[model samples]
Target: MSKPVLTIFYQFNPWDSSIGGIQTVIRSFIKYAPDEFVVRVVGTGAPGSALGVWKWTEYAGKAIQFMPVIAVGEDNVRKLIPTTIAYGASLMRHNFASDFMHFHRIEPTLASLNWAGDKTLFIHNDIRKQMDRNLGGKAILWQQFPKVYFALEKLLISQFEQVYSCNSESAQHYREAYPELAPRVAFLKNGFDPESFYPDKREEREIKRRELAQELGLPETVRFLLFAGRLHPQKDPVLGIQAIAALADPQVHLLIAGAGELEEQVRREIQALNLGDRVTLLGAVNSDRLAQLYRAASAFLLSSVYEGLPVTVLEALACGTPVVTTDCGETPKLLSPDSGVVCKERTAEAIADALRRVLANPDLYSSEACVRTVQPYSAPSIVQEVYRQMLHRWQYRKAIAISSPYPS
Candidate 1:
């Protein structure tokens, strides 16, 4: 039999310039997609770009078709429903059909409105919590019609075939909040390309560390605590800076990588706190460079106020760098005595205390042990599981569709 067609509404550009944890996960999926299905991705171009033929774009060395829809608004609250319909319209001419559909970082109802009900919505963050936090607090629920948007979110979750939560915390949240929809929920943690982020040899790691120190005009002896993610309120980059300032040890330096709306605020805080000498803002390095930064770090730190499984933490663990992160998402599931520390709370004091504790005993987090902790989450394994989960759920749909031959 021919492989089942698996059309995905992936929500972002698959181009090399794309950034963020979601983009990282999508790229990995495209790279090691199971042979059980043929794939097609439908997504959007950067905001304000013109809408045109974006289909037939090559990604991860695969010549898969990609439909890049351009929408007018930034919030995407008003545009999502129409945007998905338009993309589906574009694909219909090509006789694009699938056994099932996939939606990532989105509430699938709108996008999958014109398609099959056999959908898998991958929850990347707590959307409801983010919205409650609001724009000032940096939650993304700024809709022209708040009530309608929320209603749509609710409808999508209740109607989709499955919800693959990005972490156990997310899975548990969904279960407790929406008991009726709990049966379809499951954890699907983020992963890394082990080959790219693997641990370096002893001498190699040190040499790269010293080289990076020289590049940043810092001493080779200074140990780094790396923080990579958006400088948004949700990621809590400001909290990370505050924690850095609160640390008692002068050798515990922080390397910030990423650009976001709060760049100006982050700069002002660093200046006000007089952390100029200790905090280095590298500002969004590429994947290869990020891997090097992971090796150079004494430990990785994420002070996110909320998260769904952070890809940065996954990469750090895969790179064999111990983590000292806030108690959020999959930290408890992923961390170990051999891997690194988890702060008891989100307070700057607690973060500083955790940093000091890790700094004092660096040997407790060896390269091998850190790598060993994340072996199960390699890209190949994660992709295979995704296939298995989707395939298992799609079986029910096939049984009905073969007899009905109906449209979504």
Candidate 2:
């Protein structure tokens, strides 16, 4: 029998040009998908592409078809509506021959809610919590609009046959919030590519450490506390700097590996706190470099105010690096005493204290233990299971459609 066709829709292409956890997850899904299904992806195109134009390309070594909708607006809060309209129009006009439809984020989900097929929704985070934290300081309209939109989404989400969240806790919260739609919501942990992110040998670690020191123009003796994520309000990059300053330990340098809207603010704060030497903004780094940093660092840090299952945390653990994160999303569940530290508070003092403890007794958190904790989140196994479940559900729906006198 032929494999079933599955079409995935998202705001951004799952290629080198794009950078986000959802894009990574989508790439993993396609890369490790089982032989039972054929996957094709639809995403928004680059700005140069004309509106309503469709572009075809190959990415990530997948022979599977990649489609891009030429939507003009960029991915952000202000342009979400315009982008949604353009994307939805493109989706409506395009002819998709897939047996199943998958959506990665809210924009795509909203655009395709009425499309014909058994649909799946992948929730990357607790949208409500993220909005509250991201827009907490913004105007009343900025805060209130998302609330109304999400309220409507509560009704629209029921349209999806299966809804999965990266965080189990977030899944449970969603179920509790919409008991009528609880059966559709479940948790699927985020995963990392083991080949790209794994524990380094003793000698390998030493080599990478020296290389990293040379690349950053830092001394070999410096202990790196790595923070890898977008420099946004949600990520709270400022807190990482504050925590490092609070430590007041010159030897403990913080290496931030991503860039975003708050990059200028983060740099200003670093200089203002006189942490120019202690804090280094490496800007946006590739996965290979990030994995090397993970293997070389004393510990990984995440100071996000809220999150789902952060892919960075998984990648860090996969590289056998101990994580020091705030109590957000499903991080507490992922962290154990022997593996990492979950800060009790989100303040600079709390993060500094946790970092101090982890750095002081580095042996307490063994690399093996850290690697073991994240073994269950390997991309191949997790992606295989997702394929199996999605196929089963799709087959069941096909059976029902064939049996029923009415059209599905």
Candidate 3:
């Protein structure tokens, strides 16, 4: 007999891009899926033969497929709506063939909701709400957008046989926002690949450290503090820069490695603070380079005002680097006194203090302990749990039908 089909609808491609947490999660999922299920992914991209899809099919007897939806121009709005509708219509045609539809992000979930199919939706982040709040002075205009988006979120979630959230906070928010659907919501934390991110050997670490330092024109004595994510208003990279400035520790250098809409603004702030000599903005670093950076850094810092659950922190911990993060999203649950510092206040002073403390006392947490804490969050482990829960729910429903008096 053939394995069951599990179709995933995502607005973006993990293999084609290096965008933050979402891409990381999807790539890890593909890398570690079980052998009993066939995975097919549908994503959106630029129109025509110029656009191509990537497929990975090496997992035992399981198969993987990528179907791309081509768009017309640079303006995403012109492409998004039509591509989404087309994708949904196509999936509706094959509804009876698949066992389940799994949506990795919101837009696709909204698109797949009305289709005559069984589905599951994963709430990666409360992105629409985050965007509304981050838009600041334009909040009135964008705030209304989230209200509509959340309404759609609620509606789509209701249509799903099961809804999975990346963190407990999102689960609680969904429960509070829509009490009627609380029972269907389940928590499925994101995971990492230990082999890909685990600590490097001492020789490897030293070599990478020296090479990176020389390449970036850094003095051998300087200790680098790293932040790896988009420099957007939501991530608040300015806060990380300001925190370093507040410390006034010349030995501590800030290395930012990502891009976003606020790139120019972040550059302006660096110039204003006369931090050109102390900060290095590496634009965007690839996965291997990012892993090397994590191994070389004194600590990893995240200053986001909100998040679902950042995979970078897990990656950093897996690489044996301690983390200093704000109490954003599910971070507090992940951080213990043994792993890293979690700040209650979202200010430069608070972050600076946390960074200073972690730097001054690195041995307070054992790297091995930190790595062990995140073992349960590995990609294979998390995916296995997802499969178990899904199967259990399916069996329960089957049992109910078998016991019902009206059943054939």
Candidate 4:
């Protein structure tokens, strides 16, 4: 008997040049996907280097039948409509062959929802919450658009056979939106690559600390509080800076990594706040370098106003580094006496208080504890869970084939 086929549709190709937690999740998941399933991936916005006619290639040590859609230019809306049509056509052709299909981000889900097969929708964030947040600040048309969008979102979600939420909060939002479909909405959380992210030996960890200090021309005595993510509004990078300044501790240095439209704004605030000496901006660093910083830093920090579980926080926990984060996604659930701390209020003073407390007792949060808490969230464990769920669903459909199949 041959392995069952599982097709995945994603908004962006992980093979293409990209950054962020979503892309990282796709790449990492593919790397650890079970051999029990034959994998096929359909993605959009592939760079020229990755474009091929259904390329059969190996990436991250996994065999994948790859298909990518080319964009005309930089207009995302212009490219998106066509990408959806193209991928949707492919899904229709592969519908019979594939045992099931899974979608990564929203655009792909919306585009390929017409496929008549066992499919799962992965929800990265609450679209309604985002629209609610933006309506007040956007143009007049946008002010009235979110309410309309909320209705459309509910309708679209009702069409899906399954919806995968990364955290309990998101799951609750979906369950509330369509109580009738509550059982169809499932929780499959995000995690980290345990092999690549682990605590270094105490001496080696200190060496990386000294190395980072020397490379950045900083004093070895200073403690670095690391924050790695796109410098976007939702990330609340400015609030993170304000929180650091509130501490007013000269011995603590803040390291901000990742880049985005808000980079200039963050830079200006750094200058205005006289944080130039205490804050270091690292535009972007590869996974290995990021892991090094994780091991070297005193603690990781993220002040996002909202999120659907962040991969960065998981990476930090895997590196055995404590984190100080706003209460977004599963950060609150993941926190404990030995794991890290959270600022539920999302205020500078609240974050400062939490940071101060974590900094006050360095040894209270042990590296072993940090690693242990995140063990269940490792790549291998998550991969197994996804495989089991998809397989079980596939078998259930087969058993029900004799009866009138459930309507879409």
| Candidate number of the best lDDT | 2
How should the candidates be ordered by lDDT, best one leading? Answer: 2, 4, 1, 3
TM-score of each: 0.85, 0.90, 0.85, 0.86
Better of 3 and 4 by TM-score: 4
- Candidate 1, residues 1-408, lDDT tens digits: the string is 456777777556666444478778878888877767677776766667655564565666766767665543332132435544555454444433467677674543454555644677788875555555443353453434567766766766765678887777668888886898888888887889876798888788889888888888888787888999877677888888899988956766899988766788899999999998899988767788899999988889898876778888889988888898887767767888879888877789999888887778878878888888888888878888878877776675567767896764
Q: What is candidate 3's CA lDDT for residue 365?
A: 60
Model 4 local distance difference test score: 0.75
lDDT per residue (tens digit) for residues 1-408 in model 2? 467888888767565434568877888888887767777777766667654443455555666766677544335333435555567666776666457888775554555655677788898876667668353443123355776767767757887888899988779888998898898888998999998999987678778888888888988888889999877777888998999999999888899988766778898999999999998888777788888889999899999887889999999999989999999888889888988999988899999999999999978998989999999999999988878887887788778878999985
After superposing candidate 4 on the true structure, give the runs of residues whose Cα lies further than 4 Å from its correct spot: 45-52, 72-97, 126-128, 134-144, 395-408
- For residues 272-337, what per-residue lDDT tens digits would candidate 3 score against the true structure? 999998999987777877888898887899998777888888888888788899887777898778
Best by TM-score: 2
Task: Write down the lDDT of every candidate, Cα atoms only.
Answer: 0.75, 0.80, 0.73, 0.75
lDDT of 4 by residue, 42-138 (tens): 7654345444357787878899987765532322122324444465454454433357777764443554556566777787754444455552232
Report the lDDT of model 4 for residue 205.
79
Q: Which consecutive 10 residues in model 3 have the weakest lDDT in total?
A: 71-80
In candidate 2, stretches whose alpha carbon ends up further than 4 angstroms from where it belongs are 50-57, 71-97, 133-135, 138-142, 398-408
State the lDDT at 406 in candidate 1.
73
Pairs that clash in candidate 2: none
Backbone clashes under 3 angstroms, per model: 1, 0, 1, 0
